[model samples]
Target chain A: MLNIAVIEDDKYYRKDIAGHLSRFGKVDEGKSLSDAITLFDARKYDIVFIDLNLSGKMEGLDVIKEAVKRKIPPIVITGYTSEKLVSRAYQLGCKHYYNKLDIQNSFEEQMAPFLRSLVYKQEDDIFSNSFVTRNNILIKNIKLVTEQMFLKNNKVFITGEKGVGKTTIAKFIHKFSTGSMDSFIHVDIPTLENNMIEPLLFGYKKGAFAGASDDFKGLIKQADKGTLFLDEISSLPPSLQKKIIKVVEDKQFYPLGSDQLIKSDFRFITSTNENVEGLIESERLRPDFYFMAKDVELIIPPLRERVEDVRPLVDHYINKSGTSLLVSNDSLKLLENYRWHDNVRELKKLIHSFCNCNTEMISLINLPEHVIENTIPSGQSTPLASVYTKGISNFIKKHGLKKLIETIEIESFKEFYEKNHFHYMNTLEELHISRTAGYRIKANIKKLDKERHLVH
Target chain B: MFTDKEKLLHDLNGNIVRLGSIFNILNKIENSKDQEISKNEMNQMLEDAEQTAILLNNDIKTFISINMNN
Candidate 1:
């Protein structure tokens, strides 16, 4: 069963939602903004249904902002519709937003798709052999349709650069659906020998070919009642694509050299790092196969975008090596900033290299010359004032230095305070600011901290 | 071009329907006899409608105040 939470001020609406959703999960209610904050902090619910306009001037946005930082997708329910509110909420990383007017009529029916996606899934799988990540958005996107994939027999198409764990996601879908890693047939299209592709996929009858002594069940048949994942799908031969079309549509096919039609019901998941349009236009990939696999598409972001995962990945590798080694903050910073062209594969390779080092802690000195050269130095930073060179010059040209200085005051204070070890008294004394000035700066810092979702 | 008054009334009506009053309307109709609408369902809908009405009234007050200023 799923754990669900609701944040709505209206008693009647609250009860309606609670009662309706109780069928799927235990309904926990929080009416006010404070309750919402507490609800988020105390227990991590699988899904949160939030009324977009909860009493205090769209306080729902505030709740959503908090939820996003926690990496929980908020299902926004509201009557007061605004493009601005929707855009802002999405910018803050809200995934599902629904209009109350439309949904209320058939609450259960309207939300069945999202609600039925209640398979037991963790955003991270750190405890298992496969790694977990803080990349909740990617995980949630896949999770949002996991139930539908199994229940409705929909195929999943995953697109990501090599080493971004497309196979891992495919396995996650099957594992969570079945609660085990069984009968997951993975065919790496690019790695398979060109001649072996046909015989391996659609197994041949006994004496079908020169070496065929016994009837071999195809990969498709092996994946019956399980998931069949085709990795690097663009590499699949055109001839195979034409032959597999029948299996894709009817879930039945003829084994090579056998007239008997075999029925194999398997969940299909295909992945490619290449652009689909390019593949289609160039005729490398057939459009029919692409469309069939593309019903529920998931795009995984590269490592550089998910900077939060860097330190954990580094730690995992170090711990796995059993060397009791650690990565220095500086080295981790450099690693986080580097453009991972090869994605996680590149990161794992780099981590493996670091494990071979003699030092207890892998620091900047231990990094490969090429790796260090490619990365931005952890200690160096470009001055913020120099950032809008053209715009700033124009602003100063038209307005003056006074307004520009005023604009950078908060930044200046932050820099000064940080330089003084973020100690208010020392920073104030060093800056020679009055007590009132210090108080205002401290207040602003608190405001900034809240805005950054550092404190609930 | 909807007038401010028209939009407000429309929004109010929409909320009223969404508050589960649509079920009540259905129950009143002869064709809706098939639905075994219970007292609990009716009560829940009425309670929700009443609270939303109050909230909507407050918002209308704010909108009227802003319009008066303009």
Candidate 2:
């Protein structure tokens, strides 16, 4: 039987709802907010019907908000209704709002569908899609897309910070979507060589280039009757944007250096870590191309916004690391507070490193030095240093180790100078450089400062 | 003088509970034995509605304030 909570102050109305609801399941009645909260803490309930106004106050709506925070959607029943109140209730994750006075017959007239859903516990709905997340917002968004857009083979665009699991969600959609076997094709645009992107996307004819050998089948054709996931789509060259738009529009494209067009039927899903709107405005991503898959855009929120997911993610990573260790609450708190610039991937790496150390129990001491040092105090942000470090790491990785020391020296010199009240001696001491080298560093800083000013 | 999410929520919840009482009074008037509402009863209903509106507005503002500060 379904477990239900009813929070209504009116004795007669509470009895009316409870009497009807009792026929289907156990009903717990709460005449006040405190009683409702106490009942909520005792155990989980399948559903909650919260009166929007209780006694002479709006405590019932507050109870509804609390239920939503616990990932339980509550049906709001109010004696009076206003647009703002209804909208707010929905925003708090309520699925149904009933004006108590609108009932023509018994409460069952308005509640039959909800009761049936609870009784059957159907798995066919979007909520059953196993995307491996506890975030209600993300779950709701995924459910909406799967229910409304997936079956129609509509193009989907997933965007979020790098390593925020956009590609995983795409794979999940592909797995559940009806399609041909071995049809999930993923093309990493950033990894594709600039000179060979076209040939990789569209097959090249023999002798198309000086070193061309045999004919090559492009990814589009290979993904026929299946899903093609274009990852980091924002990195795709502008020259190819129109061609991609054309392919999406017509489902047909000619191989490189060929006169005949080849038709291929495939579903398209694209993901990007870059700001697509900015890219479109700058003419980097074609407007038509962007709009082709814009109907079902899913933005996976950054980890920091969904902090509740952090503990489960950490547990998942630890379990995957194959280390039999329990993460302390303190360590989890530290991990949660640290800005996840690299998102889930970074958290996994941290857990993997801890496993490498073979620790029986992971605590605050096991956290990475940078993460520990950069953990922002509650309500205060100290982000610049860590963000700068991440930027420098990416720059070094992309540009090779050449001029590494000089880059570090210049950055450190500037950082210390700016942060230390422009103390020349302090900056020099921090860098372990003499006056001659210091003059060169100062010149470099001035040059960098002038370049930054000009760019702005 | 109230501060923090829990306190603010508590304050709003109290106001809404009071507002619910006003709604209950209006409901009683609407379902009274007489088929038609008297002018005095209608005026009382209107007054109750006004009070409910003020309380609801205060509750909404409190929620907005909490969101902004957070």
Candidate 3:
């Protein structure tokens, strides 16, 4: 069972929280900040519940700040109606927030499932048992590259297909490197339109713009000494890209309407689904920025490559939703075979919807038709016989056929080789191999060509 | 089962609550004194409230012994 701590000044509210949370796990109660701290030091609690207003010497914010400093996951339970305080609680890494007034009505529904999922219990000590040098979560080579980027004092360029967890990997880098229990400021470039980009990145001084009453510190300054993760970096306008390059290179930037230059020392971790080489070739992304970023680059593979992770992902979602659900082998196969164009994010949403809508048991009949339909090749398209004639015809005459066949397993190699008939690029496209894999195959072919020459 | 120490702790917590009520009342009087009463009287009341709040917090904390039961 998970161990939890509840800190609230109100006696009734504190007892109510303990009663509700006890249904899921063991909960210890503390009526003040001092009591809470003493209890925290005594044992390892999975989650902590903190109230924003307390009657004692210490305020609730003090408790939250202390919890954050101690690297504890805090859930803010407040009675205050101020939006500013609620937003600040979230900014300080309070995963869940609830109002005290509504505790009687919404306490169990909100806190129970959240408490269950918040506890990061180890299924087993895989990290210690496993020979892998990296953390347990980052098992793939692509994740290792991202972790290396975090260790090095350099900007990283993360490229992957959309929904392929590029941003998730970036967040992992941020969490590992900073060692601070603070939220990573995620900025999507496309979300900030051309007119808002400058103000969003660089704070505006008081009266800098019309109707400006107070000085504003932009996301960059706020994320100082932490990570400023720029998602969709390729979508940033040319002007902003130039400014970003300067700031990233120099670690100094002037705020809007400020004559004095401000320096912010923040790590820049950028991710884009666009092809970096293609972007540079089209003159959309700056070559100099690309070169600077090339030193630490991580290319996240699409979900199809890591089919082994699918079952775990499904289990993760089921556990996340706190629901008892099962997926049949056929349904699992359908999920695995389908082209996950949207990636993990889409899969998570689908699972969440299923858990919320469906009852206890989720079988093949209950599963969505689209999920099964999209997965089967025959369901959506004509049969393979009608599409293309399948036969081995003149293998030697086919250009690059031998090289393409060598890259793949011998069993399926001949089938795809004959299907594409000599066109290496078409084979790569049909098989959904990334451009990097294709280039590697091309390099191997060149090496083979030299060896053949020497033999002749 | 309530031990002698737990009983003492509960009584101390009750006293702290009583002291907090007194402090809140004095604070209100002090706030109103600035408009109607003299400056010296307001200052004296404010000091009394602050001292009372600190003493109550300290005494109650000592009575409870945060790690007593745990």
Top lDDT hit: 2
Residue A339 in candidate 2, Cα distance off native in Å: 0.6
Proportion of true contacts reproduced by candidate 1: 0.07
lDDT of 2 by residue, A153-235 (tens): 67888999987888878876665453223388899999988988889898878998866798888899998877788899878
Model 3 alpha-carbon miss at residue A187, Å: 0.4
For all candidates in order, the CA lDDT equals 0.72, 0.73, 0.65
Give every collision pair in model 1. none
CAPRI class assigned to model 3 = incorrect
User: Residue A59 of candidate 1: its Cα lDDT?
Assistant: 82
- Clash pairs for candidate 2: A55-B17, A56-B17, A56-B18, A56-B19, A57-B15, A57-B16, A57-B17, A57-B18, A58-B16, A58-B17
For model 2, how big is the iRMS in angstroms? 7.9
Q: Candidate 2 DockQ category?
A: incorrect
lDDT of 1 by residue, A348-411 (tens): 8777766765567778886764354334333333223432433687767855797456435555
Best by DockQ: 1
By summed lDDT, the worst window of 10 consecutive residues in model 2 chain A runs over A122-131
TM-score of every candidate: 0.51, 0.50, 0.48
In angstroms, the error of model 3 at A389 is: 15
Better structure of 1 and 3 per lDDT: 1
